[model samples]
Target: MTLLSLSGVSFAYAAGKTVLHGIDLAVRDGGNLGIVGESGSGKTTLLKLLLGLERASAGTVSFRGAPLDARDRGFMLGFRRSVQAVFQDPYSSLDPRQRVSDIVAEPLRSLKIGTDIAEAVAQALRDVDLPPDAAGRYPHEFSGGQRQRIAIARAIVARPALIVADEVVSALDLTTRTRIIDLMRALSTRTTFVVVSHDIALVALLCERLVVLEKGRIVEEGATREILARPSHPYTQRLLASTPRMPARG
Candidate 1:
């Protein structure tokens, strides 16, 4: 079953420059998928379409088989609760003024998903392997890895069905990156993820399926293992060659 999908979608900026071509994609329910591409490959624009932040210029972006309608309060409320996102820079993604507790609880307050926001915040902190005391601290108090974990905790605090992670670990160091990847791997058992990254290797660690985007169109897509072993497209081959291969999931 598909939770969110883009059918023949396209997008262009006001300058009349097309960023994405006719594109078709689906995010299967409870499954992890990766959208991989070089910079300016339309990957970020596609993520915006999936998140319903930007409307498609040509085709449909659907949630659960119905067109995504931002004006429909009933539909949008549900969509907001069902899909959540974690962006690239943990340092900038978080509010410097908000305490960790309030930061994590923002979704609960905005979406009104749970009654006990405090307990939910604490539980989310636990899920991310942070100490309970960490919640009372500000964003400046933690290391980069810890800050990213806080961001992840906030994303999962609502127990949303799907998470769209966009270049989530790109800003972290190598040692920190591995630990966060491991944390996400553990979290994947209970939540579906759509990971967007320039690194084939990072997405290979998280996504069961892979979609390659180049110049605003899909160049190739298939099971991650199959694509890793035998890439059929020149663009995809280059992506694989550019990144060190991470150990595949068993």
Candidate 2:
């Protein structure tokens, strides 16, 4: 089932300054999708549209086959509960002052899930490989990778059907980044993942499908391995060439 879709979506900062153009995309259930693009390739704009932060200028952004209605409180509430996000900056994404348990339980409180909140938060922490005691500590006490794990824990605490991650590993060191990626790879089986990043190699490791965006337009898209093995678009080829070693299916 397609959980989210954008049909002929176009966006512009102003009348003439368009960022995205005539894009058609769908995020299916239980699959990982990567939206690959360089800086200023309208990646952030598209992310905003996907997250309902911005509406498309010329097309429809649909959730479960219906056009998005942000004004409809009931629909939005359900949408928020079903879909969650983990953002780019781990340091800033988490509130330094909030305890880890409180941070992870934000979705549960907001979504009003009636289950045992403490148990849910604890399970989320365990899912990310963080110890039980980690919950009492603050975000400042953990390393960058651990903080990102907390962020992931928070995102999955609600058991949302889909998780949208925007450059989640970009802020971590090399060793930390690999660990986070491994965590994400493990979690990908638990829920749908939509990973947006400029790093094609990272996407290759995590996403089974790929959508290459250039100048606000989709230039190439296919199975991740097929695209990496033989890229048809110049922009995609450039992206692979620029990557130190594009990840390939073995």
Using TM-score, give the best candidate's number: 1
Candidate 1's displacement at residue 218, Å, is 0.2
The C-alpha RMSD of each candidate to the native structure, in angstroms, is 0.9, 1.1
CA lDDT of every candidate? 0.93, 0.93
Model 2, 24-93: lDDT tens digits are: 9999998799999999998999999998999889999999998999999999988898899999999999
TM-score computed on alpha carbons, candidate 2: 0.97
Segments of candidate 2 deviating more than 4 angstroms: none
What is the C-alpha local distance difference test score of candidate 2? 0.93
Model 1, 62-126: lDDT tens digits are 99999999899999999989899999999999999999999999999998775788899999999
The all-Cα superposition gives candidate 2 an RMSD in Å to the true structure of: 1.1
Model 1 residue runs over 4 Å out of place are none
* Per-residue error (Å), model 2, residue 73: 0.7
TM-score against truth, every candidate = 0.98, 0.97
Clashing pairs in 2: none
